[model samples]
Target: MILLLFLVSCNNGSGSEKIKAAVICTSPEAAKIGIDVLKKGGNAFDAAVAVGFAMAVAWPSAGNIGGGGFLVGRTAANEAFTIDYREKAPMLGFKDMFLDEKGEPVEDMSTYGYAASGVPGSVDGMWRFHQKYGSLPWKDLVQPAIDLAENGFEMTRDLASSLNYQAENLSKTPEAAAIFTKTGGFVIGDRLIQKNLANTLRKVAEQGRDGFYTGEVAEEIARSVEEKGGFIRLKDLEQYEAKFRDPIRFNYRGYEIISMPPPSSGGTALYAILKSFERYNPADYPYASAEYIQLFTEICRQVYADRSEFLGDPDFYEVPMQKLLSDEYISMITDQIKFADQHLTSEQVKPAKDLIAESTETTHWSIVDEKGNMVSNTTTLNGGYGAKVVAGSTGFLLNNEMDDFSIKPGVANMYGLLGNIANAIEPGKRMLSSMTPTLILKDGKPFMTVGSPGGSRIITIVAQAIIRVIDYNYSMNEAVNLARIHHQWLPDEIQFERGAMSFSVAEQLKSWGYELNRYSSYGDCHGILFKNDGNLQLGISTRSNGAAEWY
Candidate 1:
């Protein structure tokens, strides 16, 4: 790990351009896997595939083939694109799947068992990514994960603690218990192995997407879901396909920001917040000061208000992309923030007049290869360990992403953020998400790749990283490791990372009528800052366990 002090003196784009490529991710082992791929002639896309699959083995809490996510990248050729592999509700799924006979949400129905699992798309997504842009052999990229799963890797304190925390829930599923639980419980340095997961990875390496979506593995998943009274079935697995989508592109202070689009509110919400800050340079105000916090809070309030009302799966709902992102609309929202007397209460800041309703334990990794390929990917299984049920012998936990949808319009999902009809659950429809895999370009060259793992705080964490680097001129480490603050419209409170605010700033915010709440810590953001001199500066967050590798 690069010392924080060394990172402080490193000026982005101005340092000695010795480092050529870099990978920053949530786990040291995964980061090493990514760097190894780059060393072996793989491009950023290939390394992303390797790191992604490796994370599934080494960072199981949030990474898994049974889950799904989004990927945003700027190719070596300067093309920007996104892959939407977000999990979709199965054909058997219904709008009220989580509701009991009384029409009320059954407790834990959408977040704790096979009943909560959605049709996973990660394996398919990685396969598609490899097909489209990978330079390395598919099997070669996946072999590391298979090996890790088969041979086992030493457990870290964090991994041990996470498994223990979910011991009760994980033990409920026999398959999950056999793999995740130890005689007493996992401890640091213990070797964790999953032969079943290795076998699954081998099939994927051999047959690509078909290995998981069809045949034995798929059958096992479907059968387990059915036996457990869940909605997934063989048809859902057979029909699943990850898609390539045009990334949301917008200019912010001359830097072009590209991110995931609908079905993921991340890109849209990020743009709204960044665009609102365009007129006002945040560098003028001290970082984490009362003034800066208030400004950020107001913009987030307005943007999140819009998120609850107008964002969702474009395939299912007609999101007003153009209107919501228009100059007029952005100006109006910025005006509110610019001239605000106090924080806008949730009631005062409502969604635009008539919009079609259409939005965390998550994992993120940023990779930049020597050939100028940049990939920013964020994958997740909803809450930590997701649904806590492994597909019969698949040896991976299923995602509880069903909770991501607005099961009941006007109801808050697991993240405490309310959703509306636009985000209602539907058969084969992807749920709205806050996974913002994003990229930035300066002078048409890849500049930064960033994303985070925080249920609702992802957008804010990412936005703040960009702000700190571009506006405040902080180094990549400082940009990401700095304390973060988040505000989702409903709940109407400014969430400060425990030590995020000073006593003076906290007292000042309260004086301004803002309700403040302290969260231990949220995002585990990781990124690479492409220096002007052709170096790669990694911003691996210290807030959580992660590593940055460069060569």
Candidate 2:
């Protein structure tokens, strides 16, 4: 169940509820900074930039200047757009790079070092959005990050937890150990500082991408990755830019769904889920009942199967995003879900156990300005601590996105999906992603802002929430907080969150040959569910210590 918890801020100074602009982020300070831009008369794009930069600090594992992501937004006139800034494979990358001595491919390289790091585009991506729609000055957008970096921001409990969790791995990398982990051990509480990072932010603020790619910051990044024997080069830094594209919008029941297109698989994978499930409504079955789980899991299985087989950057492959999401196609896929509890194997679903993952720990942000514009952006460095290769010069973490490439056709990722030839690595090819930033429209007006940060589960979680809100009568909070159950098909097991449901739901389901795994948190999702009259309601899941605020 995707749970949406709305935070209500009742003003004692004035009882009247303002027509406030709201924001949700993995970091509270980041959300505040985003709302500050809105209060300053900036548009949704500016708020996205502010929120993203702040998340890089507070939720570094997921959000990074050294990474890339996707954005889906709506203009004042309700014109929908998608920005695809996901990282690309370096010029040096090749399909055989991850293979072993026996010519067998390995998956760790995609989540590990130089060969693993993709060209970073997040900085250029956010800057492009700002250039097109920002009302606030770029310098102003960069100020909060600069101050937080140089002057220092207090470490919240969540920040402390992330620091401790990644500390050991960081110690293995010289640069990361020097800055993030103190001399004795992990930097915790109030002692952590990012002086060098402040300087890096100031450089970008003062000189834009040139400050990062061709100037001092670029030198720093090149040096660190080079020293580590990784492949990212100065040229890779100079060539990166965020690409903008049209979003793929589909009708789910009656509501419109808009999501980022490739180099993001978020849209295609999610479309499959919606199209597949339109055949059955959970309301038709008891909540958390075996029938419901079986139905949802089958929908998920089919989506992953296709994702593993055909999904890739559209620039490289012809992704039939529209046809796949078509009601006719979905009916064919979803109708296969048996009411009886059962483990649908490769033989059951056919084709494969498709898997896709970009480190499960990432950050998602959504914002809507008073101009009636909405923006949803998700960023990730891939995995906790990323490559653990912090550039000594800039105090920035590099990403591990190179893994999205299909090292060799038929090989499976950790999630268990066999790769297709289309996703194979080539010099400068962008890695495919599942980061689905989305915008929802009610009668051509921005009504709800939604997105998530769960790697491969990002598609499942975001797609499920869309179903809950538009299909069921659950409130936004209830819809988001619902006990979300996940099955990607390949694993042949349904993963459930703790407090999901009663035992009968699992026992009866288990009798049908299903393996169930329980988790505490699936992903950090932040969204704003707006009432038609413009009343703002926000939800921020605690999976990543995320928060929401109305400004």
Best by TM-score: 1
Write one digit per residue (lDDT tens) for candidate 1, span 392-500: 9989899999999999977788899788888888999999999888999998988898889999999999999999999888888778888889899879898888778
Per-residue alpha-carbon lDDT of candidate 2 for residues 289-388, written as tens digits (9 for 90 to 100): 7776777788788777777777787777777665665665676676566667444565577543222214577778888877788898888887766677
Report the Cα lDDT for residue 465, model 1.
Answer: 95
Model 2 RMSD in Å is 3.6
Worst 10 residues of 2 by lDDT: 6-15
Note the Cα lDDT for every prediction shown. Answer: 0.87, 0.75
lDDT of 1 at 485: 90
Query: Candidate 1: where are CA atoms >4 Å away?
Result: 1-17, 338-341, 354-359
Angstrom error of the Cα, residue 421, model 1: value is 0.8
Work out the TM-score per prediction: 0.96, 0.93
CA RMSD of each candidate after superposition: 2.2, 3.6
- Report the number of clashing residue pairs per model: 4, 15
